[model samples]
Target chain A: MYVYLYDTFISEAKFQNTIARVETRLTDLGIAGKICRLSVLTSIEELVNDAVKNGAETIVAVGNDETVSKVIPLIADHKVSFGIIPIGKPSRLAQLLGIPEGDKACDVLSARVVTKLDLGKANQHYFLSRLEIPAGEYEIQLNGQYTARSLNPNQTITIYNFDSLAPGVVADRSNPRDGQLELIFSGGESAGLGRFFNKDSATESVFPIKKAQIQGLNQDQSVIADGYTIINTPVNVGVARSRLKMIVGKSRGF
Target chain B: MFTKDEKNSSESETIIGPSVQVEGNFNGEGNIIVEGQVSGSLKTKGDLRIGTNAKIKADIEARNIFNAGEIRGSTVIAKDKIELTKTAKVNSNVKASVISIEAGAIINGKVNMSQEAAEESQPLELQDKKEKNNRK
Candidate 1:
């Protein structure tokens, strides 16, 4: 199967750099001939139309969170599989997808295993991070640094260094049957500095939501979906079961 | 506050090496130098220097921007100064309060300074606003 590479962000030169690196890596892995790229499509609609017309089976989105967000909704309606190569800052979605930074990203492009993963929806849009309804603003001290900001409702919050809590948090909140959104409120003076500091699941949230429909969240609420901001308030969020066909890293284990 | 071995090591001034990447946004105030790769937005209140081989793809808000390497995104420098050295290669829009392009430096995109700032906002800046507006 041929892999279609898409560079949707600005800066064509950087896109060229990404293409060069991707091509080189694919060549090293003996798959260069299977890749094709179509950049500068004027708009996202054109980009997707071109991809479908090109007869591409899989789409590898290069760049960061914003780029991934642009394509997720489009591919969800189709049968094409999608992958990501994180090359921008705040690549929360890419980090969640298990993509490495820099040159190692090329290696990820070459290695692919397909799997079905859960997706979240807020109104008409799809999200890939933890959703926060009644979106409370919180600050986190990351790697000894502090980030003070309010989180938006229906946004995806990517959790790092909180691996122990991921499963419990996801299980309690994310429910395909109930159609509810999952949420976990956490953070402190430092990364891993939590209420359960002594316990193994200190940083994890045991609460899960199978289905949740929130109302009265204001009309203009802001949300961070995999680091991409969406400010559509008073929106309905629910779990979309097996909504995404992902070209995951071999070690992702679904 | 330096020992004998530490003093000797400082004298050689081994650069901050290369290939290392910072994957998150950063902010600071000082004469900082980056030698490897930085993949995020940076906001500095003082001089921001990029080393000869560094690769930075960021939306930078800083003072006294000096580049001797490659920048793949937009730069917004609010006053102080800006210098693109002989080996610099910038591929995107640059909106500086001040700018200096040395011999051999290459920029493939538009250069937006005090004059062009009104005409064009940086790509990353526009993207930020768009996302913010979408939330509204």
Candidate 2:
């Protein structure tokens, strides 16, 4: 069974046409199943659990990256295949998965090219992308063997699972299916004036880690996972190897 | 399965770039490339490469070493070859199966050329004590 999850933001007037087109396409392909529109009062855990209990073999996120983030960990935990239909802005996950926008995504999902991806677990939350932390007086312990800390505090410590920051600086260096994460210490510097600046990073180091403990030395710090979700410092990170069976396009960027 | 996009990247699993400084015991099984600064002890089962800009103060061990950096350490042991480039400067007792030193490379302390000599050589502290006795 296929259950399509729609985010609350998808109800805006801008996405009405897009939602209709996707539904029509899914029906046309005879692959349409239950549709669950997530609202403010909806319990995401209950909704996903109910879908799984009702025999949803595949859970597809019908909105943007936020929608995928909320649902992917659930379906992955339930051992169900996942898909994405990126509708609007802020859909970098779909882009990395090579799923096109709107109704075009339905065709790729119908092709059913499923691939396994590793999920990064930071404490309780599951993250598909990397985890970012400001490198400021922090101690990074990798595999509990050695500890690494930066002499310069004005940098970022990014632990990548599904390497989406494909800039040429640290390009094509991280692989999610390798059962290891790339812990990168880098500083992002912006060049240019005003809002037209571009962020360039010179990667300081790369460490392949199976387990990591990031602790702050000066004060408590913030750790951002997949961009928006923030976890406090002293975070324990481990790789959940091949945790997600995701439908991806042939042209997907890793 | 999706076709993978192949791009050239560093073959070394561990890379210490030019902008960071690492301390304490750092060891790994894979190849290591150091371009920055390191202190304490560094060891790897695979090959090690040090760039010209690197400054290292540690006990180092690897299968092979290609160094062009500046090292102030107690000992450096390589199971295979050790190549010190023209820009390299070492202040450590070094042992390897094969050793090559280019012009302008400065090497301090004793150098053991063969892997068999590693088993025959005395411990670092014992050698130091022997040298002191000879001076006396």
Candidate 3:
């Protein structure tokens, strides 16, 4: 059975209309499910826990990127599958999953094409997109053996769990399920002869790493996970061993 | 910093700014343009352009490398060619099939131009071990 967790922040009219459309489609498709609305008083974790306790076969999120990110870790390790019925603004996660916006997303969910995708962990929190730390000097230890120091003190470091979310930022390689994270370092301002001679002076360094430890923070830096600021500097980021079973569109890019 | 258009370039070209300094392992498939300071190892499938004011101390591998900056430490191996501009100040060994040095470029190390240079430019033991572990 599927349990739909709808975000309460959406407009009442649109929310009700979406629920009705989703129910109609599920009924027409002969899929079993129940709809639950998320409120300020109730936490997403609690709602997900309740769904699991009730033996929900699939937990569907009906909101935007933040909502999906919040629900991911709660159900990732479970045997149950996760689905998304995107509402409101377009999301990077939805785009990567190939889930269409509006009522059409319901159709994709109904298709029930499930794929196992890797999850990234920043300390205790899990993120599906990417994590960004402000530009700074850092000592990075990759996959236990390789250790490197940031030569540029103002370079921004980003760890990507999904390559599509990075858009034009290209790396040497990107395989989300390969149990590795894509680390990108970008920053600095070009000056001197480079500005006068080389029009393309901006540079970026990319690495495909499994585990990384960033040290030498000044305590003012913030770590942003999936577009949300979560923790301070000096954090541990890596790909989690557990995978998330997601219902994606037929032409999805994971 | 990258302009709005360069940041969104579909070619996946990378640009590092002049004021920044980075030390780590960088591997990329597209072109890279550095205008700052970079230490450690850099490997790219496409061209690598080091700006005139840049200072890099690392082993590098790329299809083609255009250096107008200062490079030291390990050898730079280019599969296709290596170009040293007038402002280029290099203090490391270089191995490339083709090498071009403009007037005023300073070199403090050996330059090897031969097919055998490819085999001699293999990554250091640490990088080789890391690659082996990645394959496993």
Better of 2 and 3 by TM-score: 2
- Give candidate 3's fnat, 2 decimals: 0.26
**Relative to the unseen true structure, what is the C-alpha lDDT of residue A41 in candidate 1, on a scale of 0 to 100?**
43
Fnat, 2 decimals, each candidate: 0.00, 0.62, 0.26
lDDT of 2 by residue, A192-242 (tens): 451143221244578888988988777668798887788898899999999
Please list, in the order the candidates appear, how each scores on TM-score for chain B only. Answer: 0.67, 0.78, 0.75
Error of 2 at A83 (Å): 0.7
lDDT of 1 by residue, B1-136 (tens): 1112322222221112232344456666444455556666766776676767678787777777788888887654546667899988888777776678989999877766775554355678876887799999
Q: Which of 1 and 3 is the better model by lDDT?
A: 3
- How many pairs in model 2 have backbone atoms within 3 A of each other, for residues 3 or more apart or on separate chains, i.e. clashes? 0
What interface RMSD do all candidates show, one decimal each? 17.0, 3.2, 5.8
TM-score value, chain A, candidate 3: 0.88
DockQ of every candidate: 0.01, 0.37, 0.17
Top-TM-score candidate index? 2
Local error of candidate 3 at A209, Å?
Answer: 3.9
